[model samples]
Target: MNTSNMDRCLRAALLGIGLALIGAPAIAQDAPVEDAAAPVTESAAAVEPPPPEVQAPSLEQAYQREFAFLQGQKADLERRLAELQDRMGAEQSELEAEIRALEAEVVEMGGEADRLEDRVFESELAVDTARENTDVLASTFLQADFSLAEAYSPDLGDRAPAAEDVSGLFDAALGVLRDAGSIRVEDGEFFLIDGARVDGRIVEIGGIAAYGVSPRGSGVLAPAGDGGLKLWNEDTAEVAEALAAGRAPDSLPIFIFESTATEVEKKGTKGLFDVIRSGGVIGWIIFYLGLLGLALVVLRVVFLQRASASTSKILDAVSGHVRRGDASAALDVLKRKKGSTSRVVSAAIRNLDRDREHLEDIVSEAILHESSHLNRFGAFIMVIAAVSPLLGLLGTVTGMISTFDVITEFGTGDPKLLSGGISIALVTTELGLIVAIPMLVFGNLLSGWAEGIKDDMEKAALRVINQYYEGRARGVESA
Candidate 1:
């Protein structure tokens, strides 16, 4: 049955049962009550009301109605239960389909995850290799003395270079190679790996050579054994200038070493004495002679300084005494004074009693004698000045001979051996000039001083002799 019919049937059956139960109660109440006292009268009989007929529902009919209603409800319940079961079944099927789809997706996602992991592993290895290669390239640049790269080296330190740093290095290397034959100057530094760090201006000639100079010092940079730089005591001024000027003449030689070997490092700048010593034995002889000449110069200067003072006053006093026929007084004045001039005057005064011509001869003799004393050690100084340069020449000749002898024995294959002779040849000649120039200057100066003093003495003696003649003539006139 349909739900509506079943509901109507159930409602009708309940209504009938309710009506029967209510009617029963009403009919029982309506029935006359039996009285204990009996009193029947003609008036009571006439007023009596008749009882109404009320029927109760049949049991069979009620049972049939209830049964039919129950049947209809059961069918309706069955129909609804069927519908709910069908709905639950459909929902279960859909959930199962969704679960299957999710399962497949999980499996596919797992495979994709594995692939991503593999790719990530390969990427890691590539990164590691790149880092290692970068390290090696940086170390090569330092060891090879690439000065331009040194400017960026300080930032690298002992760490792996970043992508940017690698790219920058590549670009810089290409740029350097483009101008490989040209000279370049850059602000850079020298890292000794474990030693000192020097910051200065660096000069480079393509890839062949590099040098650094600062207020501290200057030296060529050479590849070190420990992947760093070493300072070599080599002159590279031409290269430095070319680098600074950004150009060079082909004839100007750069700092290209003979064999890429590290040059010997000197302690400091060599002095004049050191250069002389490099000339060897001959150098020493020239140096010693120079010292002797210097000593003689000092002594002669002192002697001349003392002897060349003003002597005209002493001469005047002596001449006055000689003119008055007072030879003893002139002698006393000469004894009191000191110098070559005084001695000359004393000698002339002692022979004043001689005739005028004889007096003149004696004075001349005295002045000649004083000249020897004035010229003391003058010849020795001249000899020293002349000998110093000759000794230097002797050193040069000996050095050259030694050089040629080395060539004959060894064929001059090694410049170091050849340099031994060359240094001696050049240095000794330099030392000789160094010695001779000063000695010549001072020697001549001392000689001039000595000659001036001698001339003074001759003048003083002649003045006294002339005065003596004048006084003697006056005496003759008085006679």
Candidate 2:
């Protein structure tokens, strides 16, 4: 029906025709030979008569032979088709198996891709967390605002930190801790914003605190606005020693900076008088008491000095007149002399006519009288000396009470508010000591001088009396 069937029929017909032609040729040749042989054989006898019954192949016979030939060719074509079909089936089976294997591999690859995506996501999250932690650690562990930490910190951009960056952060934190514990003296140069430079061995106490020991002097280190180190105006020997020895002494407090904290060339202009003035009214009272004591001291000193000279001269004049046997002259000299010594000597000369016992009695009275005059106002000076300190103490107590009142009203938070009372307490006490020491010392000295003058006057008066009695006895003996 189809082209395949048509082609098969054509092939069969062609084969049949080819076979028929070949058979026709053989038949023709056989017929000619038989005819010839029969003719010959007819002459030979009756044997040829049965051969003459043989005839040419009918058309039906030829068709039968051609059909059989065509059938054989069809069988061969069918066998070839069967072979081709079998080979095609085998190839199809192999292709299907390969396709199934490829599908399974694709599924597996998809699963693997999903797992890789998840892992990548997790890795990204971990990196983000690590970056956040690093930032917090950098800010907390190291005070970022401080110059030292700011200098050491790395400038990471917006990206998260890698594994290496995290490791570096840990290293930096460890380094900070190590620096905090360890002490070192380094020879370095420090610069200031104002173009000041210092060359010295910087004593680093962890990076939190720094001090420098230089040929110039020792001082604290402070950070400038320009992120450079500037030596603070304040310094102490104790701090320098501690830094040099790599040991901090107990009770080390914060360093007190100067007026503006930047003025290194000059200190604040506060004198001792300012300190005293800071003490309020109580301090002023204490100060005036001290002045009064000083005044008394000066007056006592002047009086004692004058008494000393007058006593010496009076004794000399009276002794000379009595030794020359001129009692009236000695009395006149005693009257003319001006001092406690002269007064006492005049009393002794007036009673020269009396017996030695009466003269001694009169001289004793005169010496006692003159002793009072010599010691006049001496007690007032000592009292002033003693009272000045007590007044200062009163001021100190009052100031302390005032300070406590301030504390009760407000806490000890503001030193400025409390400083007034404290200054008063301390300054008054200091002024009291200042006033009391000289007063006590000079008072005792003036008292000693007064006693010496009194003693001198008494001795001179007794000697004059003795000489006068001796002269009288000598005159009696001569009579």
Candidate 3:
């Protein structure tokens, strides 16, 4: 049976059973008990009313139903939110992709721009080179009408270029001529002055005359004043205007306006001294001292070397005075001693009277004094030798730093970039060694020579003292 029919049949059977049982309960009431007073009457059995239709719900069931409903709503909301989030994520991804694509396009455009710039630069160089060649060709085909005067300026042929494109040739031409001292870089140009082209050291460059070309063969090169440039047109005997450079402190990097055999002859090979003064304060001081030291060496070799003999003779004279018992005279002679040894002996002689009782004291004092003088410059020479090498080492360290910086900045593809600094550092080291060795050697030799002279002078002074005492003894014997 279907579930609904089955439930109805079961309910009918339960009702019939209840009816049968109800009659039995009624029969059981047939024996009515006698009751006191008011109740001898039989009472019907009490019947319970059918259970009231089940209504409302239990607390647990109510809670469970409410929880289920809330769970269902939460699940629905989660699904909708998830769908919205997924859509947003997709849009974001698309945007990021689009941004990446735009960035790539921008990078490509930048690279294209750089390439185009490089091409333009190359084209400019080519045009410049072409113009220089044109100038050479034109000069080679100079007509009789054309004339060149001072090295600074020259007149060109009357024929102008047929095409406007050909004028670029003059760009290189004018630049070369300007740099050569022929014309001022500021001068605009000398375009066919008086139907002829005149170019030279232009004192003043005027403006492009609205009417083209000046009446006289000369035209304004640019709007006007002068830049003190030497321009000359020897054919016209027109002298160029320029500031005199002869009195400048150092040689300037000026190009020759005119090539003259005499000027080249006069200016022989000039190097570091002309290019730049050694810049650092320390370097400047070192160079100046080097010059002074060089001068001192010359002085010593030429003048002081000759004076040493005279110094020796003075020692001899000092000796003779002591032997003659003229202590005052001997002291005066000692005062005249200027060399290392002489100064030491003079120290002893100055106190001869007090030192007579202890000659050893005299000798000691003199030896110490002489020793100090002899070694005075020796240590200085060694120091100079040491300092030079140290300076070179410092330079090497700095140069290496510079080399590394160059490598970091623009790798080592081109050695030429850093080679010069390295060369300078190495060359400086060599120069330092060259300077130090001779100085150290000479210093040592001079010290040794001074010591030797001091020793000889002391011995001679002692001899003179001994002789004077001997003469006194002989006179005592005669008495």
Highest TM-score scorer? 2
lDDT of each: 0.74, 0.72, 0.52
TM-score for each predicted model, relative to the true structure: 0.49, 0.51, 0.38
- Preferred candidate (TM-score higher): 2 or 3: 2
Q: Candidate 2's residue-wise lDDT over 139-222, tens digit each?
A: 643463253363356555555546776676667767777876777888876643355686877776665566666666566765
Clashing pairs in 1: none
Off by over 4 Å in 1: 1-176, 179-190, 193-227, 230-267, 471-479
Model 3 over residues 154-211: C-alpha lDDT tens digits? 2344663344324444454455456554322233234342234444323322111111
Give candidate 2's error at residue 37 in angstroms: 99
Candidate 1: TM-score? 0.49
Model 1 C-alpha lDDT per residue in residues 32-72, reported as the tens digit of each score: 44332456687876998555656666656776777776887
